[model samples]
Target: MDATESTPILLREDLPGGIARLTLNAPGSLNALSDAMLAALAAEFGRLAGAPETRVVILRGAGRAFCAGHDLREMQAARAAPDGGRAAFADLFARCAAVMQAIPALPQPVIAEVHGIATAAGCQLVASCDMALAAGDARFGVNGVNIGLFCSTPMVALTRVVPRKAAFEMLTTGSFIDADRAAGLGLINRAVAPGRLEAETLALARQVADKLSGAVRIGKRLFYDQAQMGLAAAYDHAGAAMVENMLWRDTDEGICAFLEKRAPDWPR
Candidate 1:
């Protein structure tokens, strides 16, 4: 099989400065996370995880909405299966969770550029990223409760980024919140005008990409590793990373450059 077969459900674009943009391409379905799309995402993210040149990743959806969540039509079709879709649903959620976990596990940082509406699993995608930038008018919610499905999967990522009360309200009430409110709740990093969304997102990605790739990678790894540890353990883990980083040749050059009032000659 050709390892690089192109899929219509997803698009990958390489930009300068080691920045990559992954676009969800099924706008007609509101960029829903169908099985095929999830597979495509997993494939691309897997490829990127080992790409030493990629320093940052920006995720966005084509057309109006960022994503409307899972493809209900696809799920409904699986109801005729031997087990009444139980097996299918289980596999779907498992694959989706793997893709979500892959974001933070990647050596590079991932940023979500969102607009229109990001609901249910879609909102979970935003929360899974290292950071998110959304259009001022974009709406977000984990509204599976309205359809009796209950967004239990989405709650995993949502509760991690936002406060418990805020996450519970959105999950239970199936209510949508504006981008500004999402930002204030810590679900998104910032909210900009619709016309400026792409530009602002690229600008942020470029800023991150401009940093020393080695330092950034180490920092990203340490950030997530320490986040789940107790205070003492976290400090111990972070201290080791700091000591290792300080001994790197690039770090020495950076410090010398700073004292000499000149730019560090970092590798591209």
Candidate 2:
């Protein structure tokens, strides 16, 4: 697909190495999640959910920044509403939550390939991914407080991904952390040199691709399920997952290949 010719919100394409890339394409505003952009993202993420060749997925910005958050100008207009009609803002927030949830719910892992500044909703995108890798010195934060607006949707992922105080600090202060610090705070998976960001990310993406496809999909699904359960329920849930996986044909094929001293052909 000529992703460049697609809507100025998001673009999708199959890259080599069984990877899919979803580029946030509103370069003029650091790829901020406009309403149209968020809607497009939901659709493309749905497509990736069913793609057999999509072993892993990457989310990145087109130009200078990953995403600056929801379009503040939209908020400004909402705030300027006559007679305090700001319910539109709630709709906007809900849509942002849906878009963010879609990332983590993907059957295959999603990687945030952040390069430049990622603030507010952009930083939430980083927190919501299965893994986040950034170019060294890249900046990130839920920088809404400084503007007297709250990063509500961002807080959901941020609180889940980072420690409590650390997550709140970013929200309360709206200050940015450099890549290394972001990783240390558990917001980013790792930091690589800017020149080598794509190579490093693709290498990691390829590593994900080399795994059994069915296991990756099923395992990722179960992983999320288990995360939300109580500790005792988690064991019971994993037990069910184990039973389900044990009967799968891939397991039988995997064991057979192991005994035969050859790599098994994993089925998707």
Candidate 3:
């Protein structure tokens, strides 16, 4: 099926080697995360969680800007509702947060292929991913504070990936950092020329996809699980995961292949 044609708010393409690219499809609004857009993304992530064929996911935007954040017009319209938009705003943020959390929960790794500007909730989306690769000209910020709406939701993911002081500074100042600066702050893995952004992101995705899927799944789960634990507990959990991984047939084959000086014949 043509995934891109199947959805008006989001585009999906299954590339070679089990890499799935999901592009935010609203280019005219700079790919703002409208309510429909968030719903589409959440649904796609739900499907991919069970899709065994999908080994990695690449998230990109369709327009000049990666994402400019929430649809202000939509949000403003909600204010006319009887409850003064409180319930609507609550639901919107809750759904958006679930979608962000879903990225790391998926079995496959997710890479944010970012270019142009990624601000507010857009920046939150980038931080939610397992990895991010941005074009050299890209910019990132969680600048909701500038408009009187502090980026509380984005802060959850941003502070986890970036240092406390740096994250605090960005949150308070509503200032943007260039791609290179984002990389330095651990928000992205690397920044490359705009022309090479897709190629570089694909290469990185392919590298992860080349690994044994079961092992990768286990590792990905453990990586996040251990992060929230104490050092001793983290080690204990990771040790068990390592033991389980070593028991897999693929692990044995890989070890034997290494000793024999040949590539492992992994199952396709």
Candidate 4:
């Protein structure tokens, strides 16, 4: 249902051990990236960026589908604006891109809990996350081309995660891939049974949250930063990161604990 003043566009739940769950709440629209939804996401992501206590984030949608992409009605309505909605369209896309970029920029690793369908920009959302776990029955696609609105923005994230040829085929054909196929394409970590999707995602979130938060934060930043560099540069950047990481007191304690055959007594 469309979100009324009494309903939230997005919902956040903080679990024990610093795991934060953000649910896209516009199920009536399949969590479409409407202007209000985009604004809510940006605001929540901004808040999370400063929340050092949040070690991991899991983004999911309420209702049957994860997301159905942009709201067609909202986009069509923008055409009523002066300038033929060109400026509005541009601003909308820019804001959406910011939210997508914020995923990797976050200190906490973000995991997408996907079910049902994630298409067009929704698929981009999945690809932008650090990792994803989808239900076996879930479907993914960048199908804007079928409507004459090529998913160029979504393509940016899609191409980075999946192979070039595969991305191109999906974009051109506007075909959806099942979760197993998506996992094989490296789009998601794995596909779990529909009944187990929530439990599996929460378990993975807790597993990551259980790690040393400082190390995970540093490593997450370096991982994305080094991915864009030349091999030699990447190696140099990674080596420097390792040096910085090794100097942490927790690292020293962890190493000592391993040698002593004891559980790591890392500071919380």
* Candidate 4 residue-wise lDDT, 1-268, digit = tens: 7677898989999999999999999999999999999999999999999999999999999898999999999899889987888998999999999999999999999999999999999999999999999999999999999999999999999999999999999999999999999999999999999999999999999999988899999999999999999999999999998999899899999999999999898865
The digit string of per-residue lDDT tens for model 2 on 137-173 reads 7999888889897888789899998999988888898
* TM-score list, all predictions: 0.97, 0.93, 0.97, 0.98
lDDT of 2 at 153: 77
List where candidate 3 sits over 4 angstroms from the true fold: 1-7
CA displacement after TM-score superposition, residue 240 of candidate 1 (Å): 0.3
lDDT of 1 by residue, 147-200 (tens): 999999999999999999999999999999999999999999999999999999
> Of models 1 and 4, which has the larger TM-score?
4
The CA-based lDDT of model 3 is what? 0.93
For residue 84, model 3's alpha carbon misses the true position, in angstroms, by 1.0
Estimate, for each residue in 198-245, the C-alpha lDDT of model 3 and write its tens digit.
999999999999989888988899999999999999999999988988
Model 1, which residues run further than 4 Å from truth? Answer: 1-7
Candidate 4 vs. truth: CA RMSD?
0.8
Clashing pairs in 2: none
Error of 2 at 64 (Å): 0.9
Best by lDDT: 4
- Please give the TM-score that candidate 3 achieves against the real structure: 0.97
Positional deviation of residue 102's Cα in model 2 after best superposition, in angstroms:
1.0
Give lDDT per model, in order.
Answer: 0.94, 0.85, 0.93, 0.95
Provide the global lDDT of candidate 1 against the true structure.
0.94
Count of backbone collisions within predicted model 1:
0
